[model samples]
Target chain A: MNGFAIVWQERALFLEGLWNTVSLVVAAIAISVPLSALGAVVLVEAPRPVARLARALIDLTRCVPFLLLAYVIYYGLPQLGLRFDAWWAGLVTMTLYNAAYLAEIFRSAWLALPKEGFEAARAYGFRPATLYRRIVLPQIAYASAPLVGGQIIVMIKDSALLMIITVREISFAANSINANYFTPFAPFVVAIGMYWMLSLIVEAWVRRVASGARLRYG
Target chain B: MTWAAFETLLTGAGTTVALSLAGLAIGVPLGLALALIRWARIPVADQLVATYVSLVRATPLLTFVLFVFFVLPTMGLELDPVPAAIVTLALNTAPFNCEIWRAGLTNFPRDQLEAAEACGMTRTLAFRRIVAPQLWRVCLGPLVSEMTILLKATPAVAVIGVVEITRAASRIGAATYDPLPPFLAATVIYTLLIAVIVQAQRVIEALIARRYGYAAP
Candidate 1:
């Protein structure tokens, strides 16, 4: 078979890698967003000690590279006598790292609100929980959606780093294909092209959401 | 894992600092020049610089580092990994710096320029006396933040075989077969280094703001 035919024959394997990438992103973000939102809310409302600790941890996480963090999670966890599969390792690391960033975005959005908005919510006989659920979340979502969209784009790019820990993501699959075919160029080029297409889709979605939020909230 | 191995990793920190500083030295001026070419209505240079910014910003740092370290030599221009990585990192960062600096320049008040012109000041003198000072003051915060990113990005050089702290840790890990201690030690070093850079940038920013009479909101 020709080289192109050989590549075509591996289509299922490559598509599986793409599927893994999508599922990992969806799972990680699905888990992280609510946790991050709660962290952000608590960070803003909690007592001084908890707030200080949360801020410090977030700062440290943001400053470290994701690959290094993944390495720690992937390799360091075994010392505690608990092992994670490569998929779980990637999910955990991505969620933790991106949570730190998203929490900051969330906190900033909350802080930007008019102080009178909170007063008005309290004056309306709404419980704190009901107030936040009804009034605050919608506003924060409108304000923070653009930044959160950027974070999602970043997360997609970062899924490639999972290759270091042997997860069969797009980049990892490409590397393996290159090893078999001895053509590094095609695989890497494909990986880049795939990443670019993903980012463009993300950017378009962000724009649509941002415009919708402006129309609804403004 | 031993104290001796840890000491070797600590020694490599100096090289990381030097490479970062060298990149800053070249990148600042190059970035400023690009910003001016874009802002000053230079015909061909403006479009080219804008495209350069978008392309560089869109691509991953890892790809650029890999290309510099691996691909350039095959095209006949050879550089050691240290220089190659430095070049790539600086080029990767320059676009953002250029755009940020230009934004700072645009933030200057138009009335000041008109006032300088009213005083019969030449354009160069007007920029020197009125615009440049305010630009630097306004630009310092963004510059400090960008510098923090550049410091963080020095680890990327380790990918290209530079024996920076990250590479040193990996080497020690391979030889001793204890990846945790060295990697953890490197992590602590990185954290400490970032803290120091960030605090130093803050101090300098405050001092410059005070000296220049720039008000913070």
Candidate 2:
């Protein structure tokens, strides 16, 4: 197609943007996973007041649209004597927004666990620490894997939103090319393809891990 | 002056809510059709629908909106901006709702459908009487939650120059150079909207439980 020629000429730019997207995703997930785990544990195991506070915070964050949240961090915060570069702003928004969602996913999985197992673990003279260590985390770790992977895919797809913040992610590259060439077909299609492939790869990897966990746990 | 800004934001929020609800109003039935096709396992259509759902699910909504808004005009098929947006959102949601519908369809017992067929009910009739009610009961919760996500995602359409809530907020922020207050107000509207949605889910779930006597967990 005529448009493919334009896209091919822009391959270098596209590849650079792809790299940035991948790097941002990796960093966001690395940070957010632990934060979500902490949030999940707080929602599940903490005292009532602490858990309520955590939930309200999560709910408030989750309800706002991610675009507005990004604008808040990037635009709003700068006026309040805080400024962040586009990359870090994107990273923080991605981490904080999805951590709220992932925490909910993890917390729900934890809640859905059979209470009988925990009770039995307690009945067997297991201390709370050992009971959770030996029993709870393992169960939830596997159960939450597929969901966590799904959320990771969501994060990857959503990273496109960073384009608006000038993050130079793949979508940004595509948008820039469209601006230059006025050919929307090829560049956006390529961006979509890259995203689709990344999601498929993540899906395959998660399937392998989930199956392995099933075999080991079952 | 702030009241006027709030009025603008309120109008935009109405647009946002209207678009999402209209999208779902179309999406729910369209999604069921996709699920039914998949459930019946039609040969070419099964694969076609699968690919459609996968492509839609994997790509970002922004890209999809852009393609609809920009690329479709290139093909000599033009849609006005509002229709284009509704089309984009309805198509965007159909695949997700298809998955949700498929889960309910799959879990529904096969023998009941067969019994309905044996009792001289047509396929459509069977689906209407035997399948639809329970599907609603099974699906209402997840469907409502998905609606909330779609509501939040309404901002993605703003990239195409749709002046929905987030877009309106951005405009106000740009105008006043005080982005925080407008965006914060937008956040409160969204939070309240989502809270109402979640509450409605509870009330409807309770009503369905009472009506149906209980459904499969």
Top model number, DockQ: 2
The residue-by-residue lDDT of candidate 2 on B1-217, one tens digit each, is 2998999999999999999988999988899999999988999999999999999999888888888887898999798877888998899999999999999988888899899989999987988899987897788888887899899988988877889999898889989999999999999999999999999888877887788777446
- TM-score on B-chain, cand. 1: 0.91
Which CAPRI level is candidate 1? acceptable
lDDT of 2 by residue, A95-197 (tens): 9999999999889989998999899988899997898789988888889889988888888878888787788988888888888888989988999899999
What is every candidate's C-alpha DockQ against the true complex, given to 2 decimals?
0.35, 0.79
Over 4 Å off in model 2, which ranges?
A116-134, B117-124
Q: Model 1: per-residue lDDT, tens digit, B132-203? A: 766766777777778877776676666556777876776787687667888788788888888888788678
Candidate 1 residue spans exceeding 4 A from truth: A1-18, A173-187, A216-218, B41-44, B120-125, B174-177, B215-217
Candidate closest to the true structure, highest lDDT: 2
Give the TM-score of chain B in candidate 2. Answer: 0.93
Q: Which pairs, if any, clash in model 1?
A: none
